[model samples]
Target: MECLTVKQVADIKGCSQQYIRKIIGQGKITAIEAEEPINHRIQYLIPVETLPEDLRQKYYASIATDGPPVPKEKAVKKEKAKAKKPFEAYTKKEREEIMQWCEILEIWQKKRNHFESKVEGDRNVVGYLKCEYPDKQISVDILYRKYAAYKAGDFGGLLDGRGGWNRGKSAVPEVLFLQFLYFYLDDRQPAVSVCYRATVDAAKELYPEMVAQFPSEQSFRRKLKKEVPEAVVRYMRLGEKECFDKAAPYIERWYDDTEANDVWIADNHTWDVMVMRDDGSEVVHRMYLTAFLDAKSGVLTGWNVTDNPCSDSTIFALRHGILRHGIPKVCYFDNGTEFLTYDIAGRGHRTRKSQRDVPKPETILAKLGIEMKNAIVRNAKAKPIERTFSTLKEHISKLMTGYCGGKPSERPESLKRQLKNGSIPVDSEFREIIDTLIEGQYNQEPYGGTEKAYQGMTRLEVWNESIQNTIQRIASEDDLNLMLMRTTRYQKVKRNGVCIEIAGEKLWYSNADTWQHVGDEVYVRYDPTDLKTVRVYDVEDRFLYTCQVEPALLLNFIEDDKAALADANEIVRSRKKAIRNYAKGITDRLPAEYKIDMLDLSIRKAKLAREGVNIAQSSVIEPIRIDPVKETDHLQELPMASGADNVVSIDIERMNARAEMRKRNKRR
Candidate 1:
C-alpha cells in the first residue's frame, strides 16, 4: 500500500511537520512507524489507504495543485543509495575501459552489414574479432549481451550489479544494533573490541534470545562504520570543539558595511615575555595586556599593559580607546569578572545594599550610548580579540628574550633554566618594542581579513581611511583622569583628613573644605597608581573637592612612596611573624606522647588576647536604658501585702542603697 510521509501530509494539510505530528499525537490522524529513519530521527508514515476520505481527497487535490510530497520510504532508499556513489563501484581504469568498449560496440553495430559481407566471403570472423579487441577477452554471445545492456541503459548498465555484488547480509537485528551503538558511541571512547565483547556479554546477560543474531566482531565493526556517521564518532571522542571544527557548517559573519569604532571586541592576554619593573629591580613579572580591536577595520583601537588583568586594567584600556578613538557603538567581550564592572559593562544585578554607592563601570559606557554584549562562554571563535592575541603570542612574543610558551606542552626542554638565568627586559624597553612591533610591522602589513575596499591596504591604512567618516570624540585630560580612576571609598571627613586604608597602607587625603563636613561621609575616587591626589565627591555624586595627600605622607613619585611605606609595613609584619613563631615554638615544646586539647589554658589565653579580651577581669557596671524619673508614668504603686488594702509607693533612693549593699555582699 502507498504511504505518505509526515512532511507530505503536512504539505497537503498546509501545516508544519510538527503540526502534523501533533495531529497524529491527538489521534486525529493515524500514523505507522516508518521502516527506516530520516537523518537518524525516527519518522512516521501515514498510509494512503487508511486515511479518511475527506483527507484523502484533500491530499489528491494538493497533488493536482502543487506536486505530491515525496514518500519517506522512497526518500530513505534514495538517501541510502546516494551514501555510496555509483562511480565508486568501478575503478577509474575500469570505467574508462568500459566506455571504450561501448564506443567499439556502437561502431561494430553501425557497420554490421559490411562485417557480415566480409564474413560471408569466408574471411576469418573470429580472427577479425580477436584482432579488433586484442586487450579484452570477449565472445560473440557476450559481446551481444553487453551491446544490448549498453543500448538499454548506457554506461550505468555496465556498473549495474557492481554495487551489490557479493554483499553479505548481517545477521544482527536492528534492536541489538541499537543496544550495541549505545555502548560504542559513549563519550568515554571505549575500544571497539571492548565495546563488541561488552555488547555481546550484555546481550547474553539481558536478552538471551538476541545473542544468536549478534554478528562477529569484524562484521559488527564494518556495519558500525557504515551505519554511524563520522560526525557521531568525532562528537563521541573529541567533544563539541572537534565536532564544530570538523562536522559543523561554518556560518560567515560580515561586518564590511559597519563603520570604524561601531563595534569593538576586547579580551585580556598575558604576554609571554618576562618584563622587569620600572624601578629596574631584579625581580621579573608577567605583563597582562587588555586590548580592544575594532570589528570593522581590524585595528588595535586601544590597549593597556599592567601586572595583572583586573577591573582597573580593563577599565583603563576601555578609557584609553574611548578617549582616543571615540566611543564604540557596541562593546563585545567575554563574561570575565573584570568585565562585570558597571563602569564598562554596566551594573548587572544589585547584590548588595546601597550605602554611599559608587557608579558602576557600565555607567560610563551607558552615558556614551554604547551597548555591552558578552560573548558565549567556551566559544572562543565568537571573539575576534582571541585571534588577535593568538597572532601576537605566536609571531611577536616568540621573538623576544625570556619568552615563555603559553602552554606547558609547547615549552622547550631548556626553558626552565633559561628563564631563571635570562636577562629580562625592563618595562620601558618592552613597551617600546611592543609599540614598534604593532605600529611599524603588524598594522602596516597587508591584512587579508579586511573588507573588499581595504583588500590591498594595511590594517592601519584601512583604519585611517575609515575613521575619517567618524565624528571625533576626544576626551579632555581632566575627563580622562576622572574616568580612569579605579579605587572608590566611602569615608567620613575627619578633623585631620579622610583616612583611607588600602593594601594595609593608610593614606590621609585632606582639603581645607573637608573640615566643614567633618562628620559627613564623602565618596573618594582615586587611581591606585597615583595616591597623592583623590577626587572627593558628595553623597549626591557631585564633585566636592580634589583632596591632595597629606604633605608628610606624599612623596615626589609613587614608587618612592611605596618603598618608604613598604619598610613601615615590614615592621608590623615582623611583629605578627614573631608572634606566630613563638606560638609554634611553644606548641613544639610538648612531648611526643602529649596530646593537649586546643581549649587548654595557653591556647585559650592566646584566643582571648587575639579577640582583644582580658578574661581575668570582669565588669560590674552594665548601663540600664531607663531612669526612675522618666518611667514614673508607666510605674504603678502596688500593695505591699495581699491582706493590706493600703498601697505602698516604691522608695527609689532606699531601694538603690539596698541593691548596692546586696551587690557588695555577693562580691564579698
Candidate 2:
C-alpha cells in the first residue's frame, strides 16, 4: 500500500542507499521520490506496483541491452512497443498528404535557419523575400477557398500543384518562415549585411503589402534600417502561446529586477529641420539626426543631429549625452543596423576621457554588461525607440534639415530668405522653436494601449519628475581603470620557497579555497563589468584573453595562445567596426597596460590583403596566464607529508604573446 523508501529498499537489498538512488537515476528503477541519508547521501523511493513478476529473474540474468543481452522474444516485444504513435487516424490519402506537407515545412524551416544564422549566408532567403509577390492577394484567396473545399470533403484529390495541399500557387510561396521571424527580435541589430537590388526582375519573388502574409527574411531586413519600428511583428504573428514562450520570460525577468538602472535604451533619429550649411557652399545637407533614447524617460534625453549618418553616429550621440545630460543605465534601440554592434553590447561609451588618440568614432560596447536589446525584424512594439524616433523626426529633425543656404559666415543674406520660410538656426534658435511648438506635444502624445496610458503623465513629465535633482555618479579615470584591472598581483620569489607569487589575487574567486590552491600552472578570470572578483582555474593547453568575460570565466586558470584554439577558434568572433580597425594591435603591448590615452589609436589593417585602418592586437588586448600560487616550506600542511615536498613545478607555459606584441610594437 505504501511506497518503499530508498533506505528500506537498501536495507532489504543489503546495499548502500546511494546505490539504490543511482539505479533510479539510470532509469533502472521507477521512483516516487528521493531523500537523503544521515551522511547527506541521497536515497530514492519506489512504488510497489512498479515491480514486474519476472523482475527478479531478469535482474539475476544481468541483462545488458547494449550488448549480447537482448533475447529474441524480448526484442520482438520491444519493437512493437517502439512503433510511433498513429497520426489522428486520418484517411490514408489525408495522412499521406500531411506527411508530404510536413516534409516541405521541415525543409523550409531548415533552409531558413541556415540563412538566419549568418548575415551573408541568408542571401538566398533575402533574394526570395525581396521580390514582390505579384499574385499574393489572389493566392491567399485561392488558398482559403481550396482549404474550405478540402475541409468539406468534396475534393476528388487532396493534391494541388505541390502535390500536398489543394491550394494553388498564390503570391505567398511554400516556405515555412518561422526562422526569419525569430532572428529579427527588434531593431537593435548590431550589423546586417544588406543586399540591394538595382531593379525588380520577373523571376524575383514579390511580397504583397498585406500584413497577413509575413515578408520573407529579405524584405524585412532590407527596409529595417529605414523603418524605425515594426521589428517585432513577425514573432507577434506566432500564436500568443509561442510569443509567450519566447518573450514572456525575458519580460518577467526584467520586471523582477525592477531596478531602474538595470536596462537602458538609446537610439539616434533624424530631427526636424533647422537650416544651416557648409562654410560657403550653397549645397544643402539634410542633417540626419540620432538619439540615444532612454526607455525610462521615453524622451530624447541624449540626442544629436548631424549632416550624415555613419557607423559612429550613434556613439557620438551617446558621448554628447553623457558629457551633458548624464549616463543612462541602459540604452534601447531598433535594428536600424547601425545601432547594434558587439562593441556596444555592454559598454556605455567607447571614448575614454584620458585617451588622446582620438576615440575611434565607433567602439565596442560589449565589454560592459550594458543590456542591449535589438528589435526583431518586423516588430516595432518591442522597440519603443523607433516610435520615439519617428516623433522626433517629424517634430524636431525636420527642423534641423531645414534648407540652409550657407554657414552664418556667408549666409547672413540667406537668413532673411530662411526667415520667410520659417527656419531656426543654431542650438538657441532651435531651442526657442522647440519650446514654443514641441513643449506640449509630448503631453498630448497619445498612448492608448501602451503601459504609459496607465501612468497618466507623458514620458517627459514622468522622467523630469523622476530625475529631478538626481545626480548620476560618473566613473572617474581611477574608477574605470579599477573596474578594468584584474584583481591579480604578480611578484618574484625572494625567500627559498617552492611556490611562485602571483598578482591579481583580487581576481581569483571560488567557493573553493584559493589558500589551499597550489599549482605551478594557473589561470584566472575576472568579470569585465565587476573586476573586484575573479574566477581561477588551472591552465590546460589554451588561453584567450579576449574571450567574453562571463561564461569563459567558469574555470579559474587558463593557458595562452595554445595551438588547439587555432585549429578550432581562429576565426574572428562577432566583430564591430572599431575592432576591425585595430585587430592587429589588439595583441600588441597587451599583457601590459598601454597608454589609456591611446584608446583611440588606429592601426592600418589589411582586409583581403590591402591596407586600411584597424584595431591592432598589440594596442587593444593582451592575454595572460595565471602565475603559480606560491609554495611555503615550513614543513607543514602537505597532505602526504608533514612538509618536505618542495616541488616548484608549475605547468603554465607562457603564451608567446609577449614576443608577438614586441614584433608588432617594433613594426609600429
Candidate 3:
C-alpha cells in the first residue's frame, strides 16, 4: 500500500507538520517508523488509508503523475517574469478573512473522514463553523468551492479576487477627472458642488464631445473620497501646515521619561476676554498671555499677561518661571519673532542671513545653560502650553466679564452691550485673575495625562515628587536679572557715558572705564524694570563694565552746595586721569635708545648747512638774537674827505632804507 510522509500528510490535511507529528505521537493515527535513521533522525510514513477519506483522496491527487509522482519540494523553479503582487497587498480585513477561510479548510479536512460522505461532512462542518463564528455566515457550497481551489493552488486561491484589478481607481475619464481636481484641490477650498459645476463648464467648452460621458456630481464626490487620502486632501485644499497638524503622524513625548525641570515649553496665547487698557482711556483690547509650562509635570510654572506679545513679555515670563521652578535644561519654543529674538535664543539660532561681521552674543538661555529647541512652524500640537491656554479659555476666560468668544462667529450677543456699558476689568484686575486661575486652579488640578504613575497626582504634586532627587540649577536674583535683560543695542559712548532710551526718557550711564571708550560704538544691555545701571560690552561681546546713572547737574550754581559740583569734578578728573594713564602706558613701552635730543639734532642740521651739504630748512620759528651789537665808533669819529664826492659815503639813512626794502621783499 502507498504511504505518505508526515509533510505530505500535513499538506493534504491543510494543517501544520507539527500537528501531524503530535497526532502520530499520541497514537491517534497509525504510522510506521523507518528501520534506518535518515539524516540522524527517525522518519515516519503514514498509510494513505489511515487519513480521512477526503484527505486521502487529496493526498493521492497531489502526488498523481503520468510516469512518477513529483515531490512538491523538488519542483523546478519557473523562469523570471513579471512579478506578482505580494500577499501583503491585500487590505487588513481581506487578509484576515483569507486566514479564517484557511483555518476552516484545515478543520474540515481533519473531520471529513468521520462522516459517511463528503456532502454530509461539509454540512456538519458549516454548521459547526457557523456556531463557532456567530458573526460570519458559513455556506457549504462556498466552502466546497474554496476547498477545491485551495487543493489546486494552496493559499493564494483563498484571496478575494473581486475588485482586485481596479482597486482605488475610478471609471471616469482621466482628462475630465483632472479638470475636476484642478477646481477641487485649491487653497480657496471651493465646495464640491461648485467644483463639479466648474468642471462641467470647462468640459463643455474644451471637450464638447465628451460632456455627455461625464460622471454625475455625486459620482465625482464618491470618486474623490475613494481615490484621495485625507492627508493629501488637506494638503491640497487647506494648507501644508494644517495637513501636517491634522493628519501627519507625530512623535509622542513620554512625560515620565524626563524629570520635572528637565524640559520646558513656552507659547503665547490671546486671551478671549477683553480688558480695559491702563491708559485711562475708554478703550478696551484683548490681552495676550505668555506662559512657560513644565513638560513633564504639565505645570504652568510662570506666565505674564500683556496687551500684546513682545520680547519683554517673553523675557519677563521666563524670568518668573526660572525664579520659581529653577532653570530647565531644555526649553522648547516656537518660531515666533519674540522667542527667536537675539536676547532669548541668540542670533542666527533659527534665522537666515545673519550678519557675519557681528559676533553672536550670549542669550538668556545660553547664559543659564538651558538648551533652546524650536518647534516646527505652525505646529501648535507639539506645545503643552497651547492646551493650558485652551483650558484657560474654557474654564476661566468664559467666566470673566467682557468675555468675547474665541472667534467672531462665537461672540456672545451681549458682548457689545458689555463693552458699551464698561463692564470690562482693568488691566491689573485681569492680570490678578489670570494669576489666580493659573496658580490656584490649573497647576493645582489633577494631571490628565496618559502616564499611569501620575494619574492621581496633581501637576504641582507630580512636579515636586519628580524633582525630589534632582539637583536644580538655581541663579541668584541679581544674576538672573542681568541675564534676562533686553538685547544689547549699539550705543556710542558719549563724553559723559552711554545714553540709552528707557521708558521714553534718555538716561546717561557713566563708568570710569567708559572714558577710554569715548566715541566708540559698544553694545548695551539694560533691565527695563531696573534702569539704575546698564551692562556694557564691546563689539566682540566682551564685558567692559557696569555703568551707573550719571548724577543730575546742580542748578544752584550760586549756592555753596558742593556735592553735585564735586561729583562733576570727580568725573572730569577721572577722565583726565584715564587719558594720562593711557599716554604713560604707551611711553612706558618705548625703549630709551629710541629717544632723541632736540638741541643736538638742530646743531647737526646747522653743521650740515655750513658744510654746503644742502639741507632742507626747518619749519620751526627762528630764535631771537640774545647779544646786542654796540653802536659803531665810525659814526662818532667823522671821516674827513677833501672832496664832497668822498663825503657822500656818510649817507647811512639810504643804506638802512635799502636794507629794510630787501627784508620786506624777502618776506613777501
Candidate 4:
C-alpha cells in the first residue's frame, strides 16, 4: 500500500492538514509515523487504503499511472469528486430557503450544546426549527445530514441540486435537432411545426435508429429559442441585407455642424401619380423627379421633372440648385448610373473596376469645386434625400389627379378607370403642381424641431438666415450653362464640319477654325435646350473653338428663282473668298527669296544627278549672297560673294521656262 503525507490527504479531502492531524489523533483515520523527521517534527503518513471509500478511490486514480507512484515533490494535487456551485447560480427563493435552513441549523447547534442530554436537545431543536419554518417539515435525520453536508462544503452544500441537472439540456437527439435547424434556418424560413415535421421525416429516412428518440415539436422550439441568438436566426433566415438593416450598428448624421449649402444630397424618385404626355397623345407615362436637398436646412434647393431619369435631367437639376442656392462644398450621390455618369461625377470614383489608360474628363461637380461622395450601394438609409422623397410622395403625389400607389399591391383599384377616362393631368400641369407643392408648401412648412438651430423656423427661413452669414460662391448663368453642358463621345470633323445627332436629327456645326481641324476627333459640349452652337475641345479637353450650325443649301440648282439663286451664289462666293483669304494670309507670310532658294536647291540636286554626281558626296548647298545695302538703294542689283565664281547659280525664269517646256513635251 502506498502511503500519503498528511497534506496530500487533506488536499484530496478538500480540508486542512490540521483537521487531518486532529482526526488522526482521535483515531478516526489510520496513520503511521515516519522513521525520519520532516522540518524537525514527527512526520505522519496516511495509508491510501485508510482514506474513506470515495477519497481512497480518488487517491488511487490520481496515482494509477503505469510508472511507479509519483514522488512526493512531484505529487499531483487531487481534485474534489464533486464541483461546488457558485452562490449566484441559486434563485432568489432558493437562496432564501437556504438561509432559513442555515439559521435553524445554527440554533439547533446552540441548543444541543446547551443541554446535557443530546436526545432531549435534538427533540426540542426539531420542534423549534419546525415551528420557525412552518411551511417545511423537519426531522432529526434530515437535520443531521444537512448539518454534516454544511460542515463539509459550507453554504454551497445546502443548494437543492434536484431537477437542475437538465436545466438547459434538450430531450431531442443531436442528429434530429441539427436536422430541424437545417429546415428552419433557411432563406425561406419555414414554421417551427413544419421544420419539426420535416426533421422527423428526415430522421426516419436517414437516421432510422434515432427516430424513436426524437422529442416533440414544442421541445425543439424551446431549444431553438433558448440556444440560438436572435441575430443569428435573422441572419440565417432573412439574408444579409435584411439582417444588417435590423441588427447592424449605424452612425447617425448630425446636421447641426453643417451650414446651408455646405452639403447637398441628390437622388431620383418616380412619382406615385401618373400623368399624360403633353403632345396631345392619349398615352400616359410616369414622371421621375431628380432633386437636390440641402442636408442642413432640409430645403429642396433644385429639381427637374422628366419622363425618365437620365444624366441630362441630373445635370439640369444640379445646375438649378447651384444657381439658386450658390455652390455647395460637397454633393452626396446615390450609386445610380444617372447620378454616377462620367460627365457628372467622373469614372472610377465609386465603382470597383476601372479602365486602364482611359482619360477621365473633368465632371460638372469637379468643375464647380464640389467634392462628390457616394453612399453605400443598396443602402437607402444612408441618404437623407430618400426621406425627402418619401415626404414628397405623401404630400405631393397622393394629392394629384391620377393617384397611383407606389407599389403594385398598394395601387388603387380605380386607376384603370381613371386612365381610360383621361383623368390624369398633362405633363405641364403636373410639373406646375410639383413646383407649387415643393416651393410653396414643402419648403415653407415649419421644421418639426429636428435640429436645434431650426427648431422654430421653416426650411426657407433657416436657409435664408444661414445664408446671411455664409459667403455664397454664386455662379453666373453663362458660367453655369457652360459647366453643366452635356458632352458627346469623340466626333470626327468632316468637310461640312463636326456633326452631332440631336433629337434624331444630324446637325452640322462649323467655324472658320474648324476648316483647319478637318479629320481630327474632338469632344463637343452643348446644351440640349439650345442646338444653335456647340463648344469644341481637343482630345485632351483643351477648349478649341465654338462652332455654329452650318446652313443647309438648296438641293435643286435649276429652280428659276433669281433671288434664291443669287443668295445661294453669294453664300458660295463668301465661302470661296474666305478660303482664298485664308490661303493668301498663309502665303503672304513667306518671302520671295525663301521660295526662290527652295526651288534653286531642288534644281541643283536634279542637275547633279543627271551628271552622275552623288549629292551626298557634294558640299552642303549655299544660297547666293545679296548685298542688303545695295539691294535697298537700287531696284535691280546682283552682287556675288568671294567664292561665287566657282559655284554656278541658276536663274528662276530659266527654270520656269524649262518646267513649262517639259510639261508641253509630255502633252504632245
For lDDT, the strongest prediction is 4
Per-candidate RMSD, Å: 23.3, 38.5, 21.9, 17.1
**Which ten-residue region of model 3 has the weakest summed lDDT?**
626-635
lDDT of 4 by residue, 360-441 (tens): 5567788889998888878899898888888888888888778888878978888899999888899999999898889899
In model 4, residue pairs whose N, Cα or C atoms come closer than 3 Å (at least 3 residues apart or on different chains), thus clashing, are none
- Winner by TM-score: 4
**lDDT scores for all predictions?**
0.72, 0.44, 0.80, 0.81
lDDT of candidate 2 over 1-668, digit per residue (tens)? 45667655564455676567656666777887445667674445577567444543344344344222243353444345333334654568667765553443344345567664644434454344334333222232343354454555533323343445633233323232222333334334322322122112111333211223344546545444334233244343444555554655544112322222334566554443444453433443345656665554555554555565644566666555555455555566666546644234422243345643532222234333344655665554576666666565555543442533324553345545675554546544544555444446653454322453236666565556556535453555443332333322222211111121133232223222222233434444343334444433333413323212222332325646466444323222322333454654665636546532221232112233355456556656777775445434333663665565785664322324454556557656
TM-score per candidate, in order?
0.58, 0.28, 0.60, 0.66
Write model 1 residue lDDT over 415-454, tens digit each, in one string: 5666577566888888788877876777776865835777
Candidate ordering by lDDT (highest first): 4, 3, 1, 2
Give the alpha carbon lDDT tens digit for every residue of 1-668 in model 3. Answer: 88878877776676777668667766778999875365655577898888777877676676574322343676788888544445687678877887898888898788877898988887888888888878765688777778886776544567655566876667677788889999999999999999999999987667654554678888888888887798999999999988988898888877657888998898899989878877778787888999999888889987899886888898889889989999999988888888888767864445556564556566778888999888877667777777778888898999998999889997998999989988889898899988988889889999888889888999999999899858898899988987887756676888878877644667788877777778887878888788888888887888888999975532355757677778777778878988888877776676766544454456668878889866688899788763435545334766666675643347755655576567546533
Off by over 4 Å in 2: 1-259, 272-274, 323-329, 346-364, 397-458, 464-473, 476-668
